[model samples]
Target: MPSITRRRTANVGRPTSAETDILAATQRLLVNGANFTELGVQQVCTEAGVARSTFYSHFRDKIDLLVRLATELMTSSFDVTSAWKPSEGVERLADAFLQVVKVYREHAAVRRALTEVATYDATVRDFWSQELNQFTDWTIAVLRAEQDAGRTPADLDPVSATRLVVMGGERALVDHVTAGDPHADGAFARELALTWWYGVYRRPAHHGERSPS
Candidate 1:
């Protein structure tokens, strides 16, 4: 394990096994309730059982490591979301969000680190913004499909509604995870499903219709 960790170094364009141990070790520490902001590289090195040079070569600093892990977590949640298109119906949509919640809850430590570090780190913040925007963009496409099928309102602006729904859901879900409440999951999922379904996709077209200029 030490030989593998020492030999595999990260590259600008590719991934390497050098980070595997360090990532797992950091995750273990975080899972054990280690404070991310207060955690040091040396501690990670010790837990990972790699040299300091190995850790540094794989990550610029502690935040970088956390950010990478957070990035993976965000990607995982997004993947769960992408599995359900808007046309899949409210039940499936809610199920998708539930899966997303599960993913976040599974990596609760990394989720906490992501939110905390993003407050001051531009790299993590930018990555976060981009991930949300990607979701927004993808949802817009799905909304258009529903509109084209006469399921959603004819006059709905997919861009605006998608932004509101996707970003708003993101904030709500983040809060749900941070609060560490499992009882709220079902209601929250159903609420999200209802909002996206009736609030946007299934609303009467006349409700949001506009007059001609």
Candidate 2:
């Protein structure tokens, strides 16, 4: 008679090193535009150098794995901009704003692919929407702080104003990625950000105050 070892139930729920490999491989494949439908479980398992059973052990299916990968990408990107702080005035804001646009533009390929995939996919769409809202809220908070410090125009409403700024930045990036010109788009985005900052946030001169050259 052959002797068999039974697996523990407690150990069944945990992700193995193989699952981590599959997740990382899935992200790389997706970023490279690998056809998810054509690349079935066996393909992914082979790509990750894992057994088929190991792949199914961690994720319900490819979509589940893809969603997790997308979430990871968004979380990582958010971390990059989470520490943003606007300096003394509009000019400083423009500089910080350009840094963000530049980073987005550099990651244009991955961003575009994920955004396009999100359009028809409910899971991806929800993930993107939640991330966008979080980012917009952060922007609103920064603008509110600027307003309180009197660096931003007192008349501007932070909530509505921040939404407008977010929309503008979103549209700019969408257009840039769609156009296939990340460099030009980045430059234009920076200029547009500067324009919006100066137009909406700059304080008006007091009565009898001469304009500085």
Candidate 3:
């Protein structure tokens, strides 16, 4: 939820009810296909039934508001990753990513808006990068831990592999969500889960544990 590029306000406090109302209104506008770059502060203020001064008092600008929305969306998805650990087995990891895909599906609109706004806004771009890198760093740490325990290949560079997997997984999810193929989510989730599990997390010498024919 932290802004990587925006300076912190000196008078920060818990968001007031009007602030929450403005955020909700902004979200509703975005969901209704309001162009993020085109939407004006007055428009959002009007939608929220607040004064233009009220909007400025709560947020520096539209991008700041979008960043907050993006932060909320990103944090909600953390539960998926929080449930994963190196010691819990790959099934748990797979389930975790599946849950992530579900989260993506539910918040596809807001996510798509952030992606679009990030294209032109440096602040939003940094916020997006920071959010993604946090996940990538966490995954890299877990992979390194597994490698140190001899449960994964030590020869693989954890940083590079984690970036590839994380970026690729996100690309796939974005494509599926944008495509509007609801039925494809399950398959996409399964394939992504399997790719990470067998492609990275699976140890090379597990054949001995397989049941004999």
> In terms of lDDT, which candidate is strongest?
3
Clashing pairs in 3: none
Candidate-wise lDDT, in order = 0.76, 0.61, 0.77
Error of 2 at 69 (Å): 2.4
Model 3: which ten-residue window has the lowest total lDDT? 204-213
Give the per-residue lDDT of model 1 (tens digit) for 85-188: 65456678778878888877778888788778778877677767777777888888888887888877789999988888888887787788879579888778
Candidate 2 weakest ten by summed lDDT = 1-10
Residue ranges of candidate 1 with Cα displaced over 4 Å? 1-18, 203-213
**How many pairs collide in each candidate, listed in order?**
0, 0, 0
- Model 3 spans > 4 angstroms off: 9-14, 204-213
Residue pairs clashing, model 2? none
- Better structure of 1 and 2 per TM-score: 1
How far does residue 149 in candidate 3 sit from its true spot (Å)? Answer: 0.9
True lDDT of residue 79, candidate 2: 65
Per-candidate TM vs. native?
0.82, 0.68, 0.87
Residue 59 in candidate 1, Cα distance off native in Å = 2.0
